[model samples]
Target: MTWAVLLALAGAFCLALGSALQERDAIRAPGASVARIGFLWHLVRRPRWLAGSLAAAAGVCLHLAALSAAPLTIVQPLGVSGLLFAIVLSALFTRRRVRLGQLLAGLAVMAGLAGLVTLFPHSADSPVLPIPVALALTGCVTAVGAAGYLAAHWLPAGARAVLLAVLGGAALGTTSALARVVAARAAADPVSVLDWLTLLAVAVAVFGGLLQQNAYRTGHFAAAYATLLVVDPVVGAGIGVLVLGERVPTTPFDQVLAAGAALLAIAGTAVLARARNRNPEALRPASSPSTDLVHTTPGESS
Candidate 1:
């Protein structure tokens, strides 16, 4: 169990570091190309982003292993530590002094999300959504993602990053719900996984991943990452309650606390977005104009 906890923590760290590494390369990529799908073509050639992807994949595997070893009540809350990990990793990679506000904001996000999930005390069992519910969720994700992508062009870089992250997170959450359904059915009927629900989940997951990349390209790492973390579980919890028939019923007081936690997470994301002017470039933008990843030696300047 102790090893499981350690692995969970390690998974969080890997995820945070992976995002930081990916952002480092994304920022240095051509903004003009990044604004389009072409940036992926350009980014795939970068060693750093590939390494980041591998790290993220490893994190997911580790997290799954931890979940198999531990309970959801313990594992889910530990996920919040990823936000704190992101703060530390970003500061270390950027070689910037950690600002009080950034640290506090990260804690706020972590605490808010931790509180929000801990209130539920969910079980490890997977509750699959019905096909109709899965399709509806997919439609909602599609609509929201399309709208956010269109609106993103008009917003400032920081705000754009947060918006895209939220969209991506929501879509991914929906994918998770649908995935449970698909997996359960696939186990009983191996060929049944080729249904519409599985297709929808795959589509939403792909679109969500693209949205995540767009968020990174905006170069507001903390705000975007925190927002994504907040929205993903929030959306998942919402589906669990509203769609899954509240297997773990909450009291009215619990609902209020959950709302408060959501607000705190939002506030923290705003603080990160509006980084102190004195350290204007610290959280404001991720990478410098120079493509340091290309010229600088390895282990020098994230």
Candidate 2:
């Protein structure tokens, strides 16, 4: 594997590690501050959160550097490794088990992602979008993210997880897009240190971190993670094709196979979400069904 691919994989591992640490912290705090606020505060005091954040920062830095060398297609597929890393780390650290369905679903998603990555070329040519266009795109992304954030908060935990996942996914997609722009600029014309991209990179990393933490806090880890994982690649890949003008690998057969894989992933997530919804643990289950439990029967009272 190329250094760029290695760096991208490392970034994914950092993200996975950070998320697992955050989840560990969440389990400890009863009535934890909502994931967003709690994660921000945790970053202030907790050594683990700090370590995780620093790791994430390192990952982002590496990713930025990798973007300098590789295409979004190559870089983005490597990100799916984050979910794998998270699952493995979670099992090692917490002994938390993932369901069979979730595992299969994850595999499906990764397979599709890998296929997509292989199908696209790794050229460094980035489209020269006008500043206004970039700004407009950023605005749209932020608006959608904000709307999802609001919706997550408004709904109960399950729904909240779904919405937060959407937000996290979008945040990631935008981050990757920004990374491409930076890479392209660097590739096309030598730019100085700390340019427009430097600022956007920081924003994307921080915001994505915050929102992703919220995703963990809003609901069960499996469902939230699956949703976020699914959405991020789809969005990123879509942008890569539409905005970056990357060519998809040819052959109708590959396209059909990729679509099937995507469908399996989506179907798996939908099943997981619905199962979570039906399970009593996801919500505040009703109290005892027996009305008489609170008061003695008439005969007993007498």
Candidate 3:
């Protein structure tokens, strides 16, 4: 269990680094639409972006290893810490001082994670979802994602971004659950790599990436990111309990503490998302002729 926790934290760190690097490059690409195939072409040629991709791939590999050892409930909430990690990394790389709100948010996230780890009991049972259950879960996630995607186009820019991010998070959560099942099966039988579950997971991941990119393009980075932070774990943890049959403390006091901790983590993310830049120069709007071509701080978007 300790190993699993460490792996999850390591994965979160890598993911945060990757997101910061990629978003830095991604924002520089003008006229790149999420709906078009050319959207990522500009980034593909950039060495820094490529390095970010490699880092993200490493994070995924570590995440899969963590899933193989720990229940999704334990792993998913911990993944929320990635945003906290990103804030610190962004400050360091950008040579900016960390804001008080960002520091407080980080502390809140850590407190929540500590509470969860200390209160949640370890489960030795395998997190294997039967085919029927997995199919049902996939169907539900698809329906919700589709709804959110459609609604995004109908809403105002800020709200649209948040809705799109929520959809992205849902897809990501589903992918995580599917990946866990696939990993478990592969450990038992190597042939499980060829299973439909693996293909579905890949498809969901692709779709989620598209949603996330669209959200980034919407220009309300803080709200979109905060929404993703909250939704991803809620969806993932719900599936963990329902599909994976992971157990949590049933006592009222433990339940309250768990819920409070989750809320604190989410509140921390929201606070960090709204954190203002201490550097006045960093706050200036881009003067580029193309409104689409703008640079954003890593902590603000990714």
Candidate numbers sorted by TM-score from highest down: 1, 3, 2
TM-scores for every candidate against the unseen true structure: 0.85, 0.72, 0.73
What tens digits encode model 2's per-residue C-alpha lDDT throughout 1-302? Answer: 49999989888888778776765554343342233444455445767766766776777777777778987768877877776676567656655466666566666666666665666555545555555666676778778877665545446565566667777787787777777677667776666325765576567657766677766654356666777778776777677777767666568887786677677667656655554322222233223322321221121100
lDDT of 3 by residue, 111-191 (tens): 665566545655656797777777777787778877776655556545556677888889987887788778778888999
Best-matching candidate per TM-score: 1
- RMSD, model 2, all Cα superposed? 8.9
Q: Count the backbone clashes (under 3 Å) in each candidate.
A: 0, 0, 0
Candidate 1 differs from the real structure by a C-alpha RMSD in angstroms, to one decimal, of 5.9
> Candidate 3, which ten residues in sequence have the lowest lDDT sum?
293-302
Among these predictions, the greatest lDDT belongs to: 1
Q: Any idea what lDDT model 3 has?
A: 0.67
